[model samples]
Target: MRGLMGRTAICILIILFAATAVAAAQTGDDAVTEGNITEIYSTIDTCDITLTSSSTIEDLVIDVQLVHEDRIIDRETLNVDRINANSRTIKVIRWNVKTSEDGAYKVLVQLLNNEEEIASKEYGFVHGRQVIPEVVIEGTIANSEGVTAVIRPVKATLVDIDYMLVDGTDVIYLAKDEKISIHTTPLTVHKRWNTLLLNNREYTGLVKVRPSDEVNAIVVTDSFSSMDDAKITDVYKDEIGASATIEGGSQVPFDGYVRFTVYDHDGENVVESVIMRSPILLTGDDETVEAIWENRLREGKYRLVIEIIGNDGDVLDIQETMIDVEKSVTISNDITEVVEENNSSPSFLITQAVLVLAAVGFVLRRRNIR
Candidate 1:
């Protein structure tokens, strides 16, 4: 009786194993190929899911759930008519939460075919407070035709920028809806105003930066004057002196001098400095002024900084040029100048001839007396 009972138990266990194998064969080898969850904003989350199948599936249903601390915060269901064999499908899901506090969250997803579970996936994320961007206008630079606003962002942020050039109460130029990404570094944005179109006067520059998450925009205002009417048009240099031609524009008269400063090849040592006073320049007038450094330069390289200074000691324009001295002028030019001076003086020649005749007569008279 004991041997018969043991055989019956063995038969029952074999039958159960056969049933489990048959169920697995019918389900097919479908799987969740990829899945991820990311917090895009403070309260917005996106889930990306990919499903792949080895065999065709009919009436596919995808169930997605967002859970926090064992509680279902949100649930979404997706339906697809069919998925071909040896193919994959992609689905995107988004969830908006009411809180922005830091917390652990999960995206639970399940893929089913005809009420049979085929694949499942879970993605976890920790939501944290989003960083709001902040920026400040460091300064403004003005040129003859344009203005540049220097901005420094405190953090990485997306922002809209606006620039305006104002003349007294009138808006002369305006730029709006300029979008840019700013990092933790200085950024310069330039806008052309063509200050030559307007009279020489003081103008106000305005810059506005608006962050996406902020309600109010940050504003910065600075004053910059239109370029002075006087500008250096031509530069001429030699070993002894540097000369520049100053041209006057249509607006104002220019009464300035040119200051020439000489520096070593590396611009580290000051060699010499001189100033050449220029006549008052009227509109549409150009004049050349030269500054002689006196000390001739050797055969080498040097840097010349020329500044157009007004009568009021205001610098109107500045320029820089590199001078390569090929030949030394001290020996050759000085000797030539001395010979020319002696030859050009008629009085010195006549006096030397008279002294020669007088010496010859004295020698003859002394010999005759002996």
Candidate 2:
């Protein structure tokens, strides 16, 4: 009876083993298995997932996805109609590692047939090498007449930008909804400064960029502030100098300089010119500056012109007046200079007589010596 009972127990154990084996086979024990992930480097990273299956799958569509630190990077799909049974296959995938943060990654390979998943597997791998993107931003640049800015990328970003202008200096500012309106004449660089505005704050800089209208327009309009509203009330002439009044009007503050130009007779000759500025002024404020000719005036004619310049060095208003200096001096082009002598004065005759006497004495002395 003991021997019979032992045989029955052995048969029951074999039956359980067979049932477990059958269940394993039906649940894709013969299906695709997770394989190794190899990273090949050449400009970018190409990951190949090695998979093998013991059962054939028809109309196969294989997908290999790359994920870095639980974040999906990219996916590659292939149409491999029929995969033979007991075959090892490699699915290729490409991804940019430099664009992603440095961390551990996992590559998942999945096989599909008849729109149904046949087998799915995942293999985790750490990506150490960084593959930078070939191009971050690429575009074309064009400009209209008179420095109209042309920028394609509005949301693009740049770091450590240095810029300057003809009147102002280097400036840096955040490019956010920043409308760059450039209206300028052909002006040259005058001075340079080291102040900049980054993310709405000002800082000092050492790097220098071209002060072209395109760049400086943005910096000057945003980083710096200027309000130009002035009136030049026809320049007037004084005894030996010319003066003009630049009155800030229009209820706007003026924050620039005043330029004065005094011409000689015709408007072509620039006799005296000067630039004066009070820096800051409010509405209805006025400042007067004079450009004086230190020497006594020669008299004939003169013209005085005064101009109000904006912070960008643009001429706001120009007022010119012609003044006739009525004096005793007369000049001619042929004769360099001519001074009218007093005919009734006795000093002229006395000078002529003395000159004649000196000439006669010299002649007499030469003859006596001979």
Q: State model 1's lDDT.
A: 0.67
Tens digit of lDDT per residue, candidate 1, span 1-370? 9999999999999999998888776543224322212111112354445555555666878788888889888887877566556665555454666764577777788777677766676766666545443877788765435567787888777788766666553345666655688887888887665333444577766566777666445656667655445789999886778789998753334666889999999999989899888776655578989888778887788999999887567887999998777642222355445546789788876776676668668756643442
Candidate with the greatest lDDT versus the true structure: 1
Which candidate comes out best when scored by TM-score?
1
TM-score of each: 0.32, 0.28
Candidate 1 accuracy as TM-score: 0.32
| Whole-model Cα lDDT of every candidate shown, in order | 0.67, 0.48
lDDT of 2 at 158: 32
Worst-scoring 10-residue span by lDDT in model 1: 34-43
Candidate 2 Cα misplacement greater than 4 A, ranges: 1-226, 250-252, 328-370
Per-residue error at 276 for model 2, in Å? 2.2
lDDT of 2 at 233: 63
